[model samples]
Target: MGDDHWLDLDTSKYPFPNTLWHIKPPKEIAIKVTVMLIVGIIGIILNSIILHILIKNRWLWSPSNYLIGNLALVDLITLLLCPWFMLVRDFYQQYVLKHFGCYFEGFLQASLLLTSVGAVMLVSYDRLAAAGLTPDARVTKSAAIKLIVITWIASMLLSLPWITHREYVERQWADYLETFCAEDPKVLGIYWHFTLFILVWIPLGLMVVTYGAIMWRLEWSAKKLSSKGAGMAVSKAKTSAMRIAACVLITAVICRIPYTVLIYWRNRLSNEVNSVEGSFDAMWFAANYLIYMNCAVNPLIYGFTNRRFRKAMDRTPGIAWCKFGSWCCVYPVYKRKRILEVDKNTEKVFVIEGTPRPNRKLAHVIKNILHINKETLDFSVKIDEVTTKPTKITPLKI
Candidate 1:
């Protein structure tokens, strides 16, 4: 299109008011900044505790845990750095004019952003493996550690270009500073294709396929176990996995889908599109941030849906009060012995108290199958006599 024709074309095609910069007044900006700061701090603290549990509890180290740890580290960095942007957006909307502020904001934004994309990709694969596991399957610790390293490295490399190419320019009509994050035609063309394939489409697409298979498998198990008198455990697992898979699907749709579509269009219409005059930046920020928040939200899914994470979070004091819905009521289990005397018609039976729900169910099933129900009683009646005879029982007060 010629310049005259382009000028004649209505600019309203670019919809929505552009209020991303100085949209809110100073006071409002402060409030926004403060809220973001507080949330970021809490996220960092909670993610740190998650990392600690995954590390200290050797038994919990698995491929899924490694993905979660990498995500937490990404969130930690984002939270730590976002407050500076919050301050600038609040107190110094025009601070992009300052060279230091410009580079800092641009670099951190790119880091948090590209890292987030990579982290989500890793999480998608991790969840795929985790969800694909057989009822008794688990991803090994060595594999998990290796994947975690790969996730960090991939994310770092993806974000490196932004750090290297970011520069500041002047825009006469707009704010004094124009922060142009490097969008090199050739380089970005390659990156767009590469990221779209590996990070955007492949990982998310695999998640959809993997989770579908997992749900199908879990549903099949539930159906099979229904007639086997397996109680609620199988059903509960199936239900939990289904919900988590749904959440992941929703997250991918809301976060990745739009960006992917926009990027495809942007690539096709490269020079044809001069500038984004609409609410693109705002929507982009919202979508991207929501995706980044998924890292924090995963811990919540674990806390609510996965019993082990809930128990660990309860014991982890620093993160217990974050109100991310990961809190649980936990009673400390202790080992103890009781002195007892046995009599005829009574057998030796031990009750393992304070066991988790899954273990409790399994233990009860095993005990019932073995026909061993005794409270420190003597087996003097007869050989293989499965009889329930209650004798005098007194509580030993603690």
Candidate 2:
């Protein structure tokens, strides 16, 4: 097993005096690898949790949520494919992955980046439509699915250049053969500029426009309402929506702007300086860290800002186990039971739990059984006993 002559390659082509194959990773490279590994692990876990929550909960299956789920999926794929390869390339002097890995990594990164940007734009537009239009005019589930398919297709088409231009090359040093993957420098300059425009500027522009319009429309609707109560409700809703949108948009810009600037700087420098080293620099590390950090931060943003998502996460069995221990793993049997309560004055019917008690106040009965707020329940009400099975009760007119 130890007699492996295949490993003993000729070193005559190497430029260096020493012929040692092993090279110790530099401090900067080690730090970059560590940070990237940490971020990738965090991103993978967070994205998986987001996808799990979205998939497991039937109530969260809305058109908007579908797009959000797609974004999470994209980020998850990006973290899985891009970062590890980048870390490997940074740590190793010679590219271990050959031509296939080069093309695959390049294509995957380009396509996913575009898909993520497109998804974010679509989400912003979906929010705009929901805020400004009637329920009938908002995007439907079918429409959102079609949009997602189109985004992926478009991203693939846009990323075709990566497949065409990327190449695996080997150069000889004094005592080592250096291998690396790179794109056609001529094509990279033009292609990357176009990608930057699509990935950063366009999405940023759309987010601002869509979210701004939503806020304006909300404010206008609030102003048109005559009742102060209605106005306050609208104001409250606007504030909540704005808060979520602001956090998402702000984080996106902060994460992407540095990477965009780094690319721009590199492209400009490449034009002037005949050659640039493939080794990672401070700017490269920082830019990459921010971009990958975005993936981990997205789940945090949603979990923190969106009350519904937080509530859903709380109800998730896995999360429940974490919070409440192993006892939460026991599934409770739910029996179909409902009580019909009719308000005497307003004639409004409500579905309550448990058996009706004769001569007892409706609010008191509901408070004891369902633990519902008494203030929301009508004091003057009549209860009608219904069968303890899944059945609808029509409201009786008094």
Candidate 3:
């Protein structure tokens, strides 16, 4: 078309306030986008449910669960950000973000992604450690948070090169000079290597090592226990746990392998042929999204594989309420905790005795699950929990 005719054609509907950078999406690509949006929403909602279960059931806050919670939190952040970037690229087709905006968002996103993978690895390691059945020190709840913090710091440190070379630049396209945020092509190789190593390889290695060892350990233990005439229940539980670990690790590997392979392929082709984007196709776009599926599907795996988690989810109100309902509860202020133990029906049950809940009515509502008779409980203050003050136990209501 001639320039004059092209200019005369409706240009008003093409720019910002008039349009939200809405390019008419092709049918096939549009379908993929719609499906992604639906899945992303479901993942976020389900993860939110997991968060609610974790919060309400204070008893579930063990070190391993803490890691799981952290993973969920990071994946939630990833799901939120991934679509945003996709929209920016798909709709605007330009970097609307200025220099600092680009840098900050990029850094935060990379760190969150790295932290999510790190959290998954930590969860696997915690499980492996737990299976040791040794009295040696175990990872504490606080330690899990500490490890996540370290991962965040490491992610930022590793992503620094991307930030340092980042620029908002204008490039000539078919008919326009498009602006976008990106690393300098000169430093792209560096960024790619760092991203592949830290974001993919290292985490995958740890997950494989940790979960693999757990699988081996559990198999050995099962054999030994069977020989010792141990009940099948204990062996079964370990088997289930091993299966859970394997599922998580394998799913992560499968989801990420394509993305990683594509990245490597792109780099190799760049060396032999040219920039991969020059030949960008639907497969490339699909591969880009493939790794993100891991984040979206992880909660499904947890819900499916773990019986207790499934039970709690079942007990939770409707799925919608459970996922996004935590905001409704005005949680009490964080306070130091002291655990107390009571001998009950041959099982040693532990109870969370924290500073009184802000809502006085619910303060004595037993927070931890324990099977015991109400009569034997000592309502009168017993031994001082942290101090010498006698502790008071409230009656368990029917």
Candidate 4:
């Protein structure tokens, strides 16, 4: 809101006019809203598909799979919460500020924020135990389920203040702005500690320690490779290890590190220190948004870097229905419904129909006949404008 004094951080007046709820231009606001909407839609769809796939393949219910699934679900919540953000940012720009909107936006933001932290920490542990310390150390399905449940509970508890403090307040200044879903400074201070402790500090420490240990073990293993007469095997193993390490490192550096630094810096600085409405605050806000983008980035990274994930994605029926974007891919979940995708550039639409029941013997016979991997046989139908629905045809069988 344009009520500069409303923010708990500082009392300094923002040189920007208070007549309008937001200082930004309408065009800029529109652009930001559009981008957030696009990203949110894509994120939800992709993560949904991934979750469905994991469900379809029971293997996806494994401990690692459960963690990934929870991550996707958290991302889904974050995406669903974007519209509130889009609305407030737009409303603020238009000089229309409502108490309810503020609370909604702030509450959703906190919920998603906490959930994201929990999800990432869960993922870090999953990777550490599953891939780093002992590749053979598999988490039981029940344990994984318990972990996800606990993550959700923690997220809910941590976000309670935001929900509790949603209210309409008038600043001493002539400006009357609604403060939706945000706690008072004192309450928020408590929350800040919890969030920083769980989300920032703990995860950073675990990632550094676990990844470091893994790298050390990998280096030691590489040394043994030469003496074991498995030079080529060792080289390949090392390469795989390096790739995983690189992925973790990049994710940590580009996503988590900056946000953590910013939080610490903001806390340490006096209210007046960073209260000026200038390029710095704008940059800081942009940086905060960029950190949020990390949630959407996970699937893209998984699709590109993980060969098996890519191959599986390609085989998914109705993938063509997803819009193709420069930075992201969109796809439909072919679970209970059979759908055909029609995509051209950024525009994508889907037509749904009844999915065929899997005939085990028939599927095996067809796979053998077609000389293709049975796992790749994701049965689907095609739809065209005139069809109004899916038009099923016998798939090619060897």
Candidate 5:
């Protein structure tokens, strides 16, 4: 807050030299903060469940699943780290954005945001590959891993400008908090703007074209599938794929457009022919929340669009919230959650009959579960009654 010791809302740099910006009323600020708390918490829970399901089922580890897992990982990190700090800053009326918090938020945000968008794009591309657009007609597991590694590296590079320009300083206007996280606008502003363009616009364009092409291909393929049984299977897969693509595309656009537009609007405010100062603050508040809201809804998209995902979620969160009536009851079990396996010949049969021992830890539980990634395996835990056994036993890979 060297500029004025105000809460840093721009998410670009903190403690800027400009202290002339409008201030929000306490009531309005409180409302926005409340929404953030709710969304951030929900996002964390849902994304974690998604990650658990992805991790538990070893047979599910394909190229598509890898992208899905990467996505959940990024979103989980963002929901956990970014929103918590912002909520604290807003709720407490703190003028100081601590140095580490200020610098790290933008750094992590930029990297995670890029990784999220890149992942969605990867999923779209993989669908195209699966639909016979490429010679292999599938993304090899090795190639998918390489692509994921490349994405994280690229995000780190893209977000480098923020790290280099950040600073810790005393707030000029407020003495309540001695130091705040600030950015050196002169050093990083231009690069931030350029990278912002590449981050927001490039993905918007790609998603639009990629999803459109996928729809067209779906239509073309539907005609070639003439036999009823094979045609039905093709139809189901295509329909499910397109539904997911559409939902992801829509959620990303809806959440990102406002924030991107508002940032653009503020940057262009001086060039405006009319007075638009008052609404800018409100719009900025709304736009930022929109972005936050985007982080929260991927779980909803997955649950609604994919039946297997829905089933997997049902095995954890659904079981926790619906059957047990409280997440606290589900937490201990999910924390030590193990694999669920069924034999190829039998249906609805679980491999084990007792709950995981709380004292016995296994490093390979998540590893084996993820590697054995089968979506259709019955995860319904049924224990032998009147015996010293619990229903939810962690299964070893068969």
Candidate 6:
């Protein structure tokens, strides 16, 4: 097992020593790359919209929503940066970005993912407090900002191994150079296990406990309401809350658990196992797809599931236009008339006819008419009549 021993082997008959350099079938590559590109692009778009909505709406600037906004931000960055490297790796059958890319990509993905997990956990706890089960757990705006900052810092520090342990190694094959990003295998094992604990297990456990407590409290409240003959209303509310909680928990497990299992399985196998074998490769692609899908699905789960978020989304300008089209259009002008009695003593009726105008302009018009009348007597004015006449206008064609 000398450094050059691989060189002595017949290149035509032997495969590369590292599975990272093994190319998959072109068809497989095309399908996987295309699928990833779609998911990544969709995730980027969805997260961007979510982030924009959060930033634009002043009313949505609550502590819990700040955590949600942070989640969208993390998902946006992850979808934007990490996926390109992954797609490249998938297509090239090796780490093509060389040394700097190895460290940067790994660190970026790890930090963003951990940050997302932390935000989701915070959101769950925030919801628990909002449910009034743990009123003390409610956070102020300042405290929420602090928590976000701490989460990011912790994520980066925890992911520091990605920067330190990565090595971009190149080996000269018989006719071509084979390059792959290597990590300290022992460190990788420990790091991934730790990552799984933080990303999957801890969050999952917290969600179960947090949502469980909220549900229990809701059930108790429903029971109390049952005595008051409002049980049906409370029951419906409880069911809706349970449905949302179930969706959140189920999505987390579906998106994350497969990837965690894949990592665990890989780590359990011997180092020499071919990672690009058909079954394992398919599993890898499927697992990663689900992970990215999670990023896109977050806005739908957390945003649409929320009554306030749904209201805000409906109120968003362009969104209403998109949804209802011509129905959102407003009449720019309306034909209006007002009849006023200048004086009860004189029985003089003054009529004003015009399109609806601002109060100042209408007042100026009235002053002009009064000045023309040349009546200097102390006069009492009264709004004798007000009416709107419909005017025909062409409908805007979409």
Q: For residues 364-398, write the lDDT of model 1, one tens digit per residue.
A: 77865444334334333433234567533333433
TM-score between candidate 4 and the true structure: 0.66
| Global CA lDDT computed for model 5 | 0.64
Stretches off by above 4 angstroms in model 4 are 1-23, 34-38, 83-99, 102-104, 132-137, 171-183, 261-276, 302-304, 320-398
> Of 4 and 6, which scores higher on lDDT?
6
From the highest lDDT down, the ranking of the candidates is: 6, 2, 5, 3, 4, 1
Tens-place lDDT per residue, model 6, 18-121, is 54445667887788778878888877876776676787788778888898888889888888877777767766666678988988988988898899999898
- TM-scores, all candidates, are 0.62, 0.73, 0.68, 0.66, 0.66, 0.74
Distance from true location, Cα of 153 in model 5, Å: 2.0
Question: RMSD, each candidate, Å?
Answer: 11.9, 9.9, 12.6, 13.1, 13.8, 13.1
**Local distance difference test scores for all models:** 0.57, 0.71, 0.63, 0.58, 0.64, 0.74
lDDT of 4 by residue, 274-357 (tens): 253455455555555665667777665543344334444455556524422321322223421332333223342332234344
**Among these predicted structures, which one has the highest TM-score?**
6
**Between which residue pairs do clashes occur in model 3?**
49-323, 381-391
- Pairs that collide, model 1: 346-377, 346-378, 347-377, 349-374
Candidate 2 Cα lDDT to native: 0.71
Better of 1 and 2 by lDDT: 2
Mark the 10 consecutive residues where model 1 has the least summed lDDT.
331-340
Instruction: Give the poorly placed runs of model 2, Cα more than 4 Å off.
Output: 1-30, 226-229, 270-280, 323-398
Query: Which is the leading candidate under lDDT?
Result: 6
Candidate 6: list runs displaced more than 4 Å: 1-26, 273-276, 324-398
